[model samples]
Target: MIRKWAMRAVIAYFLFGTAMYVYLFFIADTAIPQMYKGTSADPATFLNARELMLSEEYSNIRNLLFFLNKPYQWLFYYLILLFGISAAFERWAKKTSKWFSLQTLIYLFWLSLASFIVTFPFAYTSYLFSKTYQISTQVFSSWMRDQLIDFWVGYATMAVVVLVIYMMMRKYKKRWWLAVWVLSIPFSIFMMFIQPVVIDPLYNDFYPLQNKQLETKILSLADEADIPAEHVYEVDMSTKTNALNAYVTGVGSNSRIVLWDTTLERLDDEEVLFIMAHEMGHYVEKHIYKGIAGYILLTFAGLWITAKLMDLWVNKRGKIWKVEGTANISSLPAFLLITSVLLFAASPLTNWVSRYQETRADQYALEMTEDPAAGVRTFQDLTRAGLSQVNPPYLVKIFRYGHPTMLERINMAEEFKQQVSEE
Candidate 1:
C-alpha cells in the first residue's frame, strides 16, 4: 500500500513539475516590458550576444535543477523509510550505547553520512556546471573541502535540533511541538547573532576593506544613512567565485558591512558605494529583525502542522515504516520529509517577501545616494559578472528569485533618474 502511494505521488509530482517547466521555459512570454524596450534598461544594450546566450542557458539549467531537487529529496526519504534503513539505523545505534543522547547522536551520524553520500552527486554536478559557466573559480580540492565542511556543520546543527525536539517530545508528549517552537525563537536569534562573528570566519578570510579610501567612502555613506556601521569588511571571494556581492549581516555589535573582494575589483568606487548604500538600506530599514519575526511565525505554524501530520502518519504506518512513534530517534527521516515538503510549498510566498524587501532596499539606495547613473551601472555590471537573466519567466521569479529581475532593477534606476531630473 505504501509503495503504491509512493509511486502515485511520484508520478503526479513529476507530471505537474514537467508541465510547469514546459510552460514557463518554452511557452511563457519573458520579453521585457514595452516601456523599457528601447531604454537603457534593455538587456541587449548592455549584455553582448554571447553573454545573452550564456545567461539564458545558465538560468534554464538552474531552473531545471530547482524543479528536480525537491522531488529527488522526497524520493530519497521515501525509499529510506520503505527499505527500513531508518529503523535499522536506530537499532544499530541502540546496540552501541545505553545512553539515549548517545544513541540519538549515533543514529544522526549514520543518517547524516548516508544523506551526504547520496547527495554528493548533485552537489558535484552543480559545481561542475558553475565551473563550466565560469561562475566558480575554486579548484576541485577546495570545493571538496568546502563540501565536507558544509556536511559536518549541517550534521552538527541537525544533531542539536533533533536532540532538542526529541527531548521536548519525551517530556511534553502531546505538546512537544509547541515547546520546541518556543525554544526555537531564542535559539534562532542566538545563531544569527553568532553566525557573523563565529561561523562565517571558518569559511573565508574577512578583514577590514584593504583599500582604505574606499572603506572611508563606504563608512561615510553608512554614516549619512545613520547605519551605525564602523567598518566595511572585505571577504576573499575571488578565490572561490567570480561573483560580485555585498551585504550587511549580524545584529547589534556583531553587525558588519561586508563586501566581496570581487565586487571591489570589478566595480568602480561610485558603483560600489551604490551597492553599499543598498546593503545599508537592509540594515537601516530593520529587515533582519522583521525577517526573524516572520521566520518565528512561520515555524510556529509549520511545526504545528508537522506535528499533526506526523501523528496521522504514525498512527497509520508506524509499523510499516518504523519501530515506534514520533519520539523515536528513528523517526528523524519522517520529520525531515514533512518539513522539507512544507518548505518547498512555502517557497513562492517566502520569495515574494524577499523580493519585496530587496526592491525596497533598491529604492532606499537610490534615495540615499541620489546617483541613479551609478545604480544603473552597478546593476548592469552585476548582471554581466554573474550572467544573470534580466527577465526570467514569471514562475521562476515566483518560486526561485529573491530579488527583482535585472531588467526591473535597471528600469527602477532609470525611473529614479527621471524623478530626480523632474525635482
Candidate 2:
C-alpha cells in the first residue's frame, strides 16, 4: 500500500509538471505575439520620440505582468502550504513527532513575538548551509538577523498592498487583471525613478571614486567612446566576497558608473581602463535600455502563462493536500520552484541571446580600448582574483554562467591581440 501510494504521488507530480508546460506554451504561443502586435500598433513618428514610444510599450508589458503575477502568486502559496504539511506529516510518520512538535512550538513562540513576527527558520537554514559551504560570505547569526529583518519589512509592505488590491478587486468585480494592469503602470514608473537612487543604497555603501588618476583614465575612455557620464563611484564590495564587478547604474540624469572596490584594489590601471571601457560600451551601445526592452517584451507572455498554469495546478491537485491557492501565505517557495523549472525550460533561448550579447560587448570593448592586451589582462586578473573555475564544463557554463568561461574569454582576448599585432 505504501509503495502504491508513492507511485501515485510520483505520477501526480509528473502530471502537474506537464500541465504547467502545456499551459505556458499554449499561452506564450498566442498572447506574446498579440502583445507584440499591440506594441507595434502606433510606431513613433520621430526618431528621437522612439524611446518614448518604446517606453510606453514597456509600461504596457509590465501592466500585463502585474495581472499575470496575481494568480501565479496564489499558486505559489498553495504549493508551499502543501510542502509544509507534507513535511509535518513525514516527521510524524517517522516516529519523530515529538521533535517536530517541539519545532512547531518554537515557531509558534516566534510567530507570537510582536517585533519579530516573521518565523521562517527553515529558509534561514538554507543560507546557513550556503555559509557552511563557503559560498555565502555572511556569518550564520548575521544571515539570520538579516533574513528576519528583510522578511518583516517585505511581509508588512506586501501584506498591506496586496490586501488593498484584493479588496478593491473583490468589491468592484470588474476585470481584476485590467485593474491590476492600471495600478502596476505607476508602480513600475516609481521603480524606474528610485531603484538606483534609493534601493541600491539600502544594501551597499556607495562613495565617489577617490583615485584621481584611475578616474581620469576611465573618463578619457568614456569620452573617446562618446559615452556621457558625469561621475564614477566606488562600491564597498569588500564587505562581501572578492568578486570583481562594474556597471552603469541608473538612467538619464541619475546615470553614473559604479565599480566594486575589489576591482580597483585588485586590477592595475590599464586593466581597470579596459573594464571601464567595456562598461562604457554598455552605455554607448545603450545595452541597459535594450535589456529592459527585451524583458518587457517577454514578461507579458511569461507571467500570463505562469498564472494560467498555477491556476490549473491548483484545480487539479491542490485540494488533496488541503492547499487553497487564495488563502495560503507561503507563496515564495512555489514561485521559486516554477521559476527554476521555467529557467530550465527556456535555457536554450535565454542562453543563446545572452552569449550573443556578451560577444557584442566584448567586441565593443576591444574596439573602444584599441588595446586587446589590456582586455586580456583584465580578463585574466578578474578570473584569478575571483578564483573562478578556469574551464567549467560546457553544459554547466551554458546554463549557469551569464558570461563566457575564463578560458573562452582568455582565448577570445588572445585572438583579438593576435589580429591587432598582425595589423
Task: Give the winner by lDDT.
Answer: 1
Give the TM-scores of the predictions, in the order they appear.
0.97, 0.65
The per-prediction CA RMSD against the true structure, in angstroms, equals 1.5, 14.9
The TM-score measured for candidate 1 stands at: 0.97
lDDT of 1 at 154: 89
Lowest summed-lDDT stretch of 10 residues in model 2?
38-47
Give candidate 2's error at residue 270 in angstroms: 0.6
Q: Write the per-residue lDDT of candidate 2 for residues 63-113, one digit (tens) a residue.
A: 233234333443433443454543333333334334533433333223224
